[model samples]
Target: MKDRKYNTTEKQQTRKTIQRNVNSEKINSKENKANNEKVLDNKKILIISLVVVVTFITILIVTGVFDSGVQQNVTQMNTESQNSTVNMANMQEINNLENKIAANPEDMESTLHLAHLLQDSGLFEKAVTNYKNYLIKNPANADARVDMAICYYNLNDYNTAIAEMENALKYQPKHQIAHLNLGIVNLTARNMEASKEWFKKTVEIDPNSDAGKRAQELLTSH
Candidate 1:
């Protein structure tokens, strides 16, 4: 009876141990499934983060604000450069004009321009020389003779100025400038009668001109 009772108790204990082992394996499988779910969630979050970063970068590119700023900077630089080039071109043109005048000493137009430049610079002696050279080369030029007379008058050589006016008059007696300049020279030299005669002649030459009207006023005034 005691042996039978011991065998029955041992069999029950072994069956209980096997049941505990089966329950342990089921618990381990549940834990593994939870860990796999967590890993899957992490992979999904990583993919979402990558997509967000790529989309943000794409948005920045699509806005084109950065490109506009770059374009504006380039345009501003180009405009400044073009302005500088224009300024340089203007300076070169001025230099070229000066060079042309210097290279052609005997050119009538250049000589005239140089004389005016010298006069403007207060270089009276050089201005006179240039005007005299022009006159010598272009003796038939009535306007140049008048210009020379003006230069001589500026140099205080009234007698030579009057002589030039007389020479211009010989070419065309009705020349208004010649008459007006002669009248002015005579008045400066204190020859009242000669001044009167030339002023009257200027009025007769061009009654519609300002010089003629002024000459008429001077003739009547005194």
Candidate 2:
């Protein structure tokens, strides 16, 4: 028997079977490698997501974004303390004012009242000093100016008294007392024209005023 000769069909069938087995094995190995790689990728993604979430939470805590509530409480406490201090100071000052007003010589009451008492006691300069002090603190005190003008009147400083009275009247246009008093002070200085004008205004503004009655009394003498 000559060496058995393989036919083309048999040779081809053999090659096909070998090639199929090799291809099948290559396909299985590639599938296993791909599955392993996919699992690794999934694990890496999960770890990265966890890290990002944790970092975001840490940043929020560190930046004081979470401390707003605590800061508000502290602010409220400070404000309350300031208000308490102010209220205490006001109470103390008001109490002192009441005590000061109830006493004598050194007692400071209404600017007008204190100055009037000192003037009546014949301390012209001292009365003037007190009125000046009062005016310094309460410059718009009309009642105090009236008393100050009277003090000047007693000092025979008719010009000063008239000026102070005019300042008082400027604040109170309808001040019947101011008009009447100004008229008399003008009369003593023989400012007849000014006195007549003031007396006429006093009569028109408040005919029932003591100043008006005083003017009428003076008229009867004239």
Candidate 3:
């Protein structure tokens, strides 16, 4: 009987030992699963952060925030090229006009045309030379004389401009444009009284004319 009791007790102790070992393994498995899930979550967060950074950079590019400087440079270069081409064309036309005038010194029509063209092109000194030559032959041309005076005004020779405009008036008194231009020149020269007088005369000459209306406006404003 004692031997049987001892064997039974030993078997029970061995079963308890095995049961405890199984429970310990179950707990270890639970802990290992939780640790693996945490690692996966961290990896997901890292991937999402990388995606957000890349998306922000792409948006900046698409919105032109980084490309504005390049666009400006391209636009400026195109404008410069166009302006250069236009200047070259204008210079060519001027050269042709000079050649024509040089070939025929006595062609008054061509000479006057060249003078007007040169004045339009802002070659004031050269235009004055041509105008002087033309006026010597056609001194009674009030229009051309006024135009030459305007060139003198542009050249800032106020005294000469005033003198030439007066000469135009002597040829054609009551010339509205000459009067208006004299007003303009006098105003630029700070001769307020002379400017007012000329403006008044321009209006008195012909109130319905363009120059007269312009003169009236100047008188009212100034």
How does each model score on TM-score?
0.53, 0.49, 0.67
lDDT of 1 at 40: 100
Ranking of predictions according to lDDT: 3, 1, 2
Judged by lDDT relative to the true structure, which candidate is superior, 1 or 2?
Answer: 1
Residue pairs with colliding backbones in model 2 are none
Model 3 alpha-carbon miss at residue 33, Å:
12
- Separate clash counts for every candidate: 0, 0, 0
Best by TM-score: 3
* Candidate No. with top lDDT: 3
Clashing pairs in 1: none
lDDT of 2 at 157: 97
lDDT of 1 by residue, 1-222 (tens): 899889999988988998899899899889999999999999999999999999988887799877888999999999999988866765565456458867876577877776666665555677778778877877777776777787788888899989988987777767798899899988988989999999999999888899999999889888
Per-residue lDDT of 86 in model 2: 68
Q: Kindly list the per-residue Cα lDDT of model 3 for residues 95-201, writing each as its tens digit.
A: 88778878988888887888887888788888899999999999999989998998999999999999999999999997999999999999999999999999999
For each candidate, what is the lDDT? 0.82, 0.79, 0.92
Once fitted onto the true fold, the runs of candidate 2 whose alpha carbons sit more than 4 angstroms away are 1-113
RMSD of 1: 16.2
Query: Judged by lDDT relative to the true structure, which candidate is superior, 2 or 3?
Result: 3
Runs of candidate 3 with Cα error greater than 4 angstroms are: 1-86
